[model samples]
Each structure stands twice: as C-alpha cells, then as structure tokens.
Target: MHIKTKFFGDIELSTEQLWHFPKGIPGFESERKFALLPIEENLMFQVLQSTNDSDIALIVANPYTLVEDYSFDIDDPTIELLDIKQEDDIFVLGVLSLKDPLETSTINLQAPIVFHTSKKVAKQMIINDNKFAVRHIIGSQPSLTKEEA
Candidate 1:
C-alpha cells in the first residue's frame, strides 16, 4: 500500500503498519489511518503520517526517553475500545512540536496515542484532571535530571 505523506514522500507501507483509530484523534475525526515510520535507523522518534490526509502528520516519540518518571493510568473505556489484552501489548507515543534550537521542543503529554502493537489498533486518549500539559518541555526538567562529574 502506497501512502502520500507530508514529511516523507510516496512510501510503501504494509497493511500491518497501518493503524486504525475508530474514534480518530481529537480534531482529526475524519482522518483515521496512520502509518508509523521510523525517522532514522535505531532512532527513538517516528513520524505518524495520516494516510487520508497528506498534510496531517506528526512527529512522535516515547515520553519515557524524555521524562523517566512519567506515568499515567489508561481509562478502562479506551482499553476496551482498543481491544487491549495485556499491558505488554500497548505502546505509548507523544506528539512533538519542534522549535528553534530543537531543545525548545515540547511534547503533548496530556493526550497520548496508545496502540496495541499486535492488533494494530490505536487511539488518542485525552487525559483530564492530570498535571500533564499539552506542551511539556522535553529534556527541560532540570530538577529531574542530575549530572555526574
């Protein structure tokens, strides 16, 4: 299956790489299909490109790499909707917004895109009543990082 993407040009994707979002992401209700493409070999970041819209694409990364203590509970409703069977089946990714210097980039932690890697089903779950924000500074939590001499 060939998909036209914003970041990447025409690319071939296997059916297994296509993710289905029944409810779709917030504001992107009509855009349901997305393909996860690795940015570079062994890189932690990936491009979540929408198959339906050429302009709809987001650079995502595992929040764990940026924030080690990051933790959140997935609502039961989303779990059932996505047909998640076990915790190991899930993979979480955060949308990244790159800015000047790149280190100024922020990730949307309040809403995470959770996927059942085996089933190929995913959903963008919105978190409410949480301390996380849509634009949390990545690698900027000075208090959380320590340096050694």
Candidate 2:
C-alpha cells in the first residue's frame, strides 16, 4: 500500500509496515497504527511513522544498544496485549529526541515500544525503573565530531 511519509514522502509501504498497537501508545492514544521505516544505515534506529497522520511520527531506536545493561520485565497485561509468546518473537524500541550537533540526541528510556513481529503487534510500554531516565545521553557523535562542548 502507498502511504505518505514525513521523511520519504509519498512512498509505497509493505503490508508488514502496518503494525497494530492493540491499546495504542501513551500520548498517541489515537495513533495506534504505525509503520516502521528505516532512518539510515543502522537498523538500530527507525522511524515509527503513523499512518493516520503523516506529520505524527517518531524517531525510535533500540535502547538496548545505547544501554546494554538495560533490563525490564514485561508484565502479563502487556504480553496479552501484543500476544507475545517466546522471548525471541518480541523486540524493543525506544523513542529518541534529536537535538542540534547530532551528539545531543537522547533516548526515552521510560517508555519503550515493544513489538511482536510474528503477530505484527506493538505496544508502547511504560516502565518503572528508578535508574532509567526519560532522557539519557548514550554516546557522543561519531568520528568527525568527537569533542564534547
């Protein structure tokens, strides 16, 4: 199906892009439907483009890559929502806020989007981890810009 994307603009999206979020995501209650589009080379980050509204999109990435020690338990309710089964079937992604200089971008650890690929189900889960910050700097930018301000 062809849908308008904020980044790619009028592009064709595969049926798999139609990811269903049973109860919808927080703040985006009405925007339950989203399509995962690649940001760049790294598969770690992608754009959670909303089908309902072209402008309503989010830059999401695998928070685990940023915080390797990151760990959280998925409650039964969430499991039922996404129809999650084996742990391997599930994947986690966190929203990111990009700031100037590229290096200033941060990850939203408080809420992570969990996806059940097999079922094509997704959910934005809010975790209660005191150690986890809603916005945390994972690393400085790559080679070209290594100096921190």
Candidate 3:
C-alpha cells in the first residue's frame, strides 16, 4: 500500500511492514499503526512513521548502538501486552531528539519502543529504573562510527 510520510514523502510498503501499537506511543496514544522505514545510507537510525498520519513520524534508533551499558528489564505489563515469548521475539528502539549539531542529538532511553517481531505489535515501554535519562546525550556515549553506521 502507499502512504504519505513526513520525511520520505509518498512511498509504497507491504502490509507486513506495518506495526500495530495497541496502546500507541506515550504522547501519541491516538496514533497506533506505524511503519519502520529505513533512512537511506544510514543504518544507525530509522523513521518510525505513523501510517495513519504523515506528520507523526519519529526518528528512532537501537539504544544499544548508542549506549554501551544500556540495559533495562521490560515491565510485566508491557511483556504481557505485546505477548512477548522470548528475547528473540522482540527488538527495542529509542526515539531520537535531533539537535542543531549531529553530536548534540539525544535519545530517549528511559522509555524504549519494543516491537514483537512475529506479531507485528509494539509499545513504548517506560522503564521504572532511574539509571537512564529521558534524553540521554548521544555524543557523550560510545556509538558506531560514521563508517560503521
């Protein structure tokens, strides 16, 4: 199907490429369905575009790639919501807050977006731990080099 996007304009995607967020992302509770679209030439980041609304796209990335020691337990409620069975069944991504300078960008580590691969469902699970910040500075963390990304 074809859908309008905030960054990529109009594009075609398979139905399997869409994700269903039953409860949707925090501030975007009304927007549930989304598609994880890759940024051209950038492996480290992706556009989590809402299939329902072209203006609601968010830049996301794997937190592990930005933070070396990033670790958090998925809350019981979220685990049950997505029907996650095993570690391999889910993948996590964090929303990014881009800044003027590339290095000044921050990622939301406190709340990671979890996707159930098989079910094609997802949610932004908020971590109860204080070890992570809502806006963790990406520049201070060890991340993939430009060549690697």
Count the clashes in each prediction.
0, 0, 0
By summed lDDT, the worst window of 10 consecutive residues in model 3 runs over 140-149
Best by lDDT: 3
- Kindly report which residue pairs in candidate 1 clash with one another: none
Clashing pairs in 3: none
lDDT of each model, Cα atoms only? 0.85, 0.83, 0.91
lDDT of 1 at 66: 78
Identify the runs in model 3 with alpha carbons over 4 angstroms from their true place: 140-149
Q: Assess candidate 3 and give its TM-score to the true structure.
A: 0.93
Q: For each candidate in turn, give its C-alpha RMSD to the true structure in angstroms.
A: 4.7, 4.3, 2.0
Q: Write the per-residue lDDT of candidate 2 for residues 93-129, one digit (tens) a residue.
A: 9999988776778998988889998889899888888
RMSD of 2: 4.3
TM-score top scorer = 3
Error of 2 at 42 (Å): 4.4
Clashing pairs in 2: none
- Candidate 2: deviation at residue 81, Å? 0.8
TM-scores of all candidate predictions against the true structure:
0.89, 0.89, 0.93
Worst 10 residues of 2 by lDDT: 140-149
